[model samples]
Target chain A: SQTIHQWPATLVQPVGSPLSLECTVEGTSNPNLYWYRQAAGRGLQLLFYSVGIGQISSEVPQNLSASRPQDRQFILSSKKLLLSDSGFYLCAWSPRAGATNEKLFFGSGTQLSVL
Target chain B: GESVGLHLPTLSVQEGDNSIINCAYSNSASDYFIWYKQESGKGPQFIIDIRSNMDKRQGQRVTVLLNKTVKHLSLQIAATQPGDSAVYFCAENIAQRGSNYKLTFGKGTLLTVNP
Candidate 1:
């Protein structure tokens, strides 16, 4: 089974501070990676998705960005934080092309609380 | 681009009782549908999924039913537990949408299992 890892189970950042959240997958190669944010009491909002290394797509333009540096590594970053950015950050991966990508497996997640 | 939605914003069921949550989609071409569970301050977890060809798919204590004719989907938990209390989201991916297989998620239903 594939496993996902995300850093800092929870984070508290002040407005305008730089932020970086990392996500990595083990036992899977070239998996599609996604970054999502769920506001308090809201549904998962797609932020970014990456299909391959050095490639990324933004679903919703905001203060956040995503990058895939390695085959199994995806990173979410922000030059400056916003109070509205406070929410639950999630990392998910699906099997890449021609693979048995049935469902998305998620990481434990990182709760970001911008103060 | 068609969208997916849920019938209810929230649902409450007693522990050990069966819980049912409903969702709706506008795209008839969607081939894959998935249900995700997200706990407080956590990321969405993969619960189960069903394809359009099958009416049902079962997993540990959970089942997913896809009513493609009516464009409706549901998740059934045989014996809902406190651990089942969370926001449930339905996502759809239609083959026609493109190779990226971008998923469109519903607003989601908050399922609260009462003890």
Candidate 2:
């Protein structure tokens, strides 16, 4: 079975501090990776998605950025965090089998509180 | 802008009863839809999905109905349990020209099951 691991399940960062959240998938190769953020009322908002290594497509423009440094490993980073960046961040992966109906598998998620 | 929205923000149901959550979408071009459940401080988990070709799909005690005519989708949970308390979200897949499709989510509806 495939499993995703996200580190620092909860974090408290001060404003303007650097942020780094990591997500890695095991038991799957060349999977489509994605990063999403969810606020109190807002739904799961797609922030970035990667098709392959070094290829990322951003859906929303904000203080965060995502990178796929290696296959099965995705990282969401920010040089300086903002108060608005606080939210529940999720990492997901889907099979890239040239099919249109791919289901996403999500990790436990990271809850960031920027103070 | 195209978006997916839920009819209700919250719902309360008694244990052992059936529960129905409704969603409405604006984009008629969306060909795929999904339902996700998220607990507090956790990432959304995939519950069930339906394509444009299918009207309904069932999994375990959960059923998803898609009505393309009204652009509405619904999720029904049979014999609802207390563990089923969570926020349910509906998502629509928007295909990008010459690129992988993106999944856009609705605001979500909170389901509370009372014992």
Best by TM-score: 2
Q: What is the C-alpha RMSD of each candidate to the true structure, in Å?
A: 2.0, 1.3
* Weakest ten-residue segment in model 2 chain A by summed lDDT: A94-103
Candidate 2 lDDT at A76 equals: 99
Chain B TM-scores per candidate, in order, are: 0.93, 0.96
lDDT string, candidate 1, A1-115, tens digits: 7889999899999999999999999997778899988777777778898989999989877988888989999999999999999998889888777733267788888989999
Candidate 1 lDDT tens digits, B1-115: 3388888998999999999999999988788999998777667787888878899999999989888889999999988999889999999986632346567788889989899
- What DockQ class does candidate 1 belong to? medium
CA lDDT scores, all candidates in order: 0.86, 0.91
Recovery fraction of native interface contacts for candidate 2: 0.64
Cα lDDT tens digits for candidate 2, B1-115: 4389999999999999999999999989898999999998888899999999999999999999999999999999999999999999999997765446678889999999999
Residue B34 Cα positional deviation in candidate 2, in Å, after optimal superposition: 0.8
Q: What is the TM-score of each candidate against the true structure?
A: 0.92, 0.96
State what share of the real interface contacts each candidate retains: 0.53, 0.64
What is the DockQ (computed on Cα atoms) for candidate 2?
A: 0.69
